[model samples]
Target: MRHLLLSTAALLAAALPVLAQEAATALPETIVTATRVPTALERVPASITIITRQQIEERGHATLAEALSAVPGLRLAPSGGPGQQASVFLRGNSSRSVLVLLDGVPLNDPSEANGAFNFGNDLLFDVERIEVLRGPASSLYGSAAVGGVVNLVTRRAASRPFAPYGELAGGTQGTVRGGLGATGTIGAFDYLASANGLRTDGFNATARRFRNTLNERDGLQAGALALRLGWTPMEGTRVEGTLRYRQNRFDLDSVPRDDPNSTGDDRRLMGQLRAETRLLDGLWTTGFRVAFTQDRRAYVNLPDARSTASTRDHYRGERLGFDWGNTLRLPGLGFATDGALNFGVTHAREEVFSLAGNTPFQTRVNAAQDSTAGHIALQYRLWNRMDVTAGLRHDAVGSFTGATTWRAGVVYHVPELGARLRASGGSGFNAPSLFQRFGTIGTAFRGNPNLRPERSLGYELGGELDLPLFGRPDFATLGATWFQSRVRDLIIFQGTSVANVDRANLQGVELTLAVRPAPWLSAELGWTITDATDARTRRPLPRRPEHVISATARLTPLPGLVIAPQLQFTGRSPEGPFASYRDDGTSFTTERRNKTGTLFNITASYVVREGITAFVEGRNLGNSRWEPVNGFQTPGRSLLVGTRFGF
Candidate 1:
């Protein structure tokens, strides 16, 4: 790992002379997650990554986890096969520290252990883009933003009167997928709607040596739907609404019984209504939004093939949220110009219910909580060459003392040098979840009502250089960031109850380079070095690799054709306390070191005509048997072929 890091540094040093001779250009695209406003990527004082729809298609990424794994400073840990539980860790932070949003609305399940968003079932259907903002962002997004935020933007109505699209695909493991969508604008109204379905006869989720290995495949089936509508009744005023729903069913391995008849179902529904208007000649922009979401999950277990009845467990969670916000273009102060102020108030209520059925330890539980928050932010351009942003927020959770968070950042650009320097610092917190506070399931687990919210303080500094190469219009970008965070009251499961019993400190460095030597070719390289430890025990955090790297190259060898190859490397790390169930009905914990592994994937796509395209993708070409989690097994090489058509 050290040698690899040195090699990467040397590569950057070798390119400096060529970069110094180049001219500056505009940033790649605009992003909204950094400040809740559309701003140029180079001007945002944060470590961020933007994945567009084209990128998604080019890579043939089917899940959010696949798409996000390539981003710098992010780690993904999948427990088993498709539809199984998965976790996303950013900068060595806990999965619960990262907040996920669908179309700007929070998607975390309040009934989950720590209010984490499970990416296992989050498909890419109708997703237009993804924006990942790294580091603490609670000053703007409130709870669960201790690590960062991942915002998914769905497809919107097209500018033309009407447009239709569809796709069909099939692959190994008896996989089949299909999707269709339409978008259009008509007079004062615009609308977009899409639907997708997928099914696969997946491989066994556990290793052959595991006691639960039934030698039976764990299959999955899923369906999703989305609809978005907008109306412009008058000038500078718009009303918009969105609806999304998804359902999935998958087979699982019962650890104790080693039965193949365990199955699980998950369903999610979301809706939002928003109104925005520009008053006072566009100087003041205001909006109000109301949103609701429901997440339901159920599991059934059949002890034997001849069993006529089954044991079941169910959980349901719902949230209702309201927000009103406005952004005002303020007059300049002294030498500063283009000043703006943003303020918003938010209120949300969450409820959860759980049932453990038909057993001696059966239990029924219900919990609810409400929160209100207010936030304000200010941005100003100073000296015509620097941008500064600051924000503060206060939240009052039910029956808990108020918590306050704040953030400030600066971006300084030297146009002539084609360089920029950025820095930011913030405080963040995660409120206890309903499941952790008041829910209980059978005799295996219990809740603690006195638990407190987890808190953190973090900061980052980075620099970017945009360089023109070879006297052509092609350019390259190189960036480096260093960050550190300290978290207090870290939550963990002790025996049968959850508690905040530890503290942690994490620090890391991320390096990224993107190059486009010509219109036909592009390449990217990203590397992350993390040092995460328990403040009390000084032990390395579990499942967090000290080094991670990813690289990709996209080549257009022929007209309307693209071939892309990608490589990902995860360095050796600690793994342990793995529970291994024995045939005697006993279980024990064991600790072991995980081996480093590398994966390779490739995709090729070609445009067949003006409105048609075809693609094929191959994943895990090396067929490595690496397990992200100690007891589970990962799939081997697989292939998929697909086609898309538009009208």
Candidate 2:
């Protein structure tokens, strides 16, 4: 591997400066899911990645796919371990093309069949950061944002009055977890609340060498709750409200038939109410939102023994949404310099219900859809170092036909040649799920109410540089990006209906580097290279994987202690374990190529002051059995110990 990336970039460039003080708390200088407002990340021309809650508490991240595993053009594809069933693929699209949110609701899964949204069973314990917006946002989030968008902001309020927090833990297949919270600022009322729970005794994704190992063991349970409130009645105006809930259950097996009576149960609830206002003096701003969501899932398989009659399934997806936005500050229609103008509108209504076989529940699905949208955008800054943006959107679902999307961007900077640049282009769409248009599974799988609604055209380009390494001066940084996309009617699953793949193409390349060089050192590295094809049978496009790498480091010698380490790499691609006696079972499948894996982890913490802390966590520490899909398998070496608190 190129001499292990040239000795891990010369050991993070010789540990970037040994040691020092003060430099964390800098990854979030402002970002609101890339362009829905609150910008600033160098004018945000797209391609973003932020995740900070003190780096998920110095890296012991639990869920949200382990805090988006290694970021940088994501590519998760779990099928086992840690509450199984996962999928996330950005640069290479498909995971129903990204889009997952909370704090703007919408968690995909309109009866699934590919509306996707599992990211391995969420749970970021009321996250306060996590805003990854990669590309194609459907001109401000309209239909599955097409390979990007993951919000999740929650957790705010705490500048005194009352602030509290907590967490507890235990580990290894008999684990236990916990959480509790409180936050405040009481004069004009500001608050936050939380609760969390977890349970485990897990380990079993079959694949005990596929030697038929299944002595039972596949467990997990979860719980969550949250609340938020705010008010400011006067001045620049503000009002807010939020609520969240979650429940989960797990234990399933059947990959190579490790069937111990499979199972799964899930639930989700969300709510929101918001209001904003700021006129004149603040350059005009307006906002309104009302949201609701509920998702329920169920699965069961008893009486196994190769299907001796016993099966069950159920799913429900619901939604009710509304939004209105505006922001204006146009410097009186003059040439540039911090000018802006943006406005948007949206509406929604969704419903989905489904049921399935073996005790007379026999294949069924009820569907409903209604959506509306409107958008407009523009931003400015010029002469002071370039920056521009533009947007447009139009959507109408339910009766099909009525879609339009657009996007534009620009950015530039050159402070004494430290350099920076960006570019963007867009269009996106995706619609056609409800079990791919009115589900009905008699012949096993069929539903194609005239399909059609999967379009795209994308672009991106980037650059960044900031020299001066060990001696200071912006202490090292480098970045690169390149992306491309093209698609039209690309939805597939043809064995008994469900089609569309007239064309397709996707491209990628991303590279990054960072080295804070002080304040107790920090390191980062990322790489990606993808190609996802199929433009007329060009093949290569199943679990998209053409190389990916990630590295991390954080050290804080002593003071209060901290240590973090991470690494990941994946290569070899192609996968399609079509299950069920293969084609004879009708889903028509074929593809193979899985071999390639590497993962390592580490975490350590200490801080017995300002609200206590103590921790240790290590996961998959090189137990490598490699199998992200084929036959499941992916669990090995675990350890955890925790503690956290705030006051």
Candidate 3:
């Protein structure tokens, strides 16, 4: 089997040569992130990828999970379809280490069962674009940003005129999806409203792998509504408010044995409001974001043991932030002084309730925490072709106290050298979640109030080259980055069959690149190598793989059309806990490693005519029989077709 896998990998590698005949174009302009401002992507000194709406539609992506499935160094674990509990991992980091943002609003539910929101069931119809920032972001985004950040930006009223658009798509896996949206300008006000729905009879979650006691078939139905009201009452001032609501019905299956029959449903809602004023050439902005989410589960058991047992988890969190940043042409410094000062506070409350017996296992846990932070950042154009930036931040979390993060970055552009050198270093911190504090599980586990926050010190160095052959325009940009980070007092779920686990330290590196040498073709490759281990034993972390890679190439045979081939690789990883399991089936015991897997996918799309287009996409084109988890084989192969028309 291993030999066959290797041979297939080789064959795929050999095919790339024939696929490289396409042409390339110059890099796209950067949209400012990290700071509440706009900046060129080339000036950020960080690794970021922006997945546009066109790409999402052309790829036949039904949800955010499907859209991100092909992004390098990103792992999306979907229990079923659009409405399932989805886990997102970046560079081998825990799902909790990644921060998600909706319309520049942080969507990480601090009150969530585990201090994170599942991205699997997140609907994506109203999103205009997605920006993925890789590496430590604590200096700007704090908390779960230790891994990276995903910001979903929504569409606004079209500048041209009021337009209405809609789409309908259905395919294998018992799926149906639809969306409707409208945007228009009314006097000095521009507004947009959109609503989308998706449903699917998803594949069986448990694939009879290993103990294979659970045989649960899952399904999902989700809907999202969004509204954006923009008030441009004046030229220098603009006020916008965005409201979004999402609901997901997810079925969760219990682990092997332990009565097996049980399921759960999850729901979430988020909102953001902001006001911006351009006073004296500086942009001043203030905003607040709020999120509420809940999870409910039911257990099925034998008639004799049929004591109605169930669990419900609820979370509520909010953030109030205000910032005043500005840009000034500094003649004395021989550069532009673009700077920003931001201050914000966050409050979160979490509660978990459960019923375990015929009567009720009524158990509830609650806590409220607050955090305050401030930051100042500056960007300078040292030369016509070079730019440098420096920033510092300070955050205070109740009980956890003061933590500071700072970074210095420089970008040197040499049109003649065909080189762009970029580098940045900073510090980051993740406060203990409410669950990690005063929370408690069943008779099996408990929380630790004495746990400390996790901290990390890291840096990244990389460069992009627009190489040229003779007098040609080069038409290609080659970029690569190498990064390393070390964390202290990492938070991890640790249990020795008796007590619950706490968070702990983690360390790792991420390497990524994008290259295009021709006008018709381009390729991107990314790999994440991590050593996320227990701070004490230094043993490898559970569920986190040591190596992961994603590669892809695009071919544009004609204008207004594109075809892309992609591959995703995940190295050997354990199927269950990393420790021994007792008779209760709960422990630190490690399950056998799930064999490495390489999946091939092809995506193609073309414009049919003005205001209309169609697309076709296929997954696992090789039809390889592989197991994402032991014994449980993934779908052999699947295909989806879709179309969209606008007026």
Clashing pairs counted in every model:
0, 0, 26
Residues 296-381, model 1: lDDT tens digits: 99999876864566789888989999999888988988889888888999999999988866765675569898999999999888
**lDDT by residue (tens digit), candidate 2, 553-600:** 899998999999888888878875464222122332567677788888
Q: For candidate 2, what's the RMSD?
A: 24.6
Total backbone collisions, model 1: 0
* lDDT of candidates 1 onward, in order: 0.85, 0.80, 0.63
Error (Å) of candidate 3 at residue 102 is 0.9
> Which digits, one per residue and each the tens of the lDDT, describe model 3 over residues 1-647?
22432343345334433333332335657575654457777767777788888777765666787778766557666443355456776765677878887765676765554566567767678887889887777777767787788998887688755888777777777777788899988888898998888777655554444353444456667788888888888886777777777776645443333233344455455555666565555455544444443334433333224335444444344444443334343333545444344445444443444334332223234666666666667666765777777767777776656778877778876655556677887777777777667565555556677666677777776666654443445544555555556666666667712122333444444445565566887777867655555556666655566667888778888987889888888777654554333324444555556667888888887788887777777877886656554433455466767777777
Candidate 1: give the clashing pairs.
Answer: none
Error of 3 at 169 (Å): 0.8
**Model 1 per-residue lDDT at 543:** 82
Greater-TM-score candidate between 2 and 3: 3
Worst 10-residue lDDT window for candidate 2 reads: 17-26
Cα TM-score per model: 0.94, 0.33, 0.84
- Compared with the true structure, the alpha-carbon lDDT of candidate 2 equals 0.80
Quote the lDDT for 4 in model 3.
39
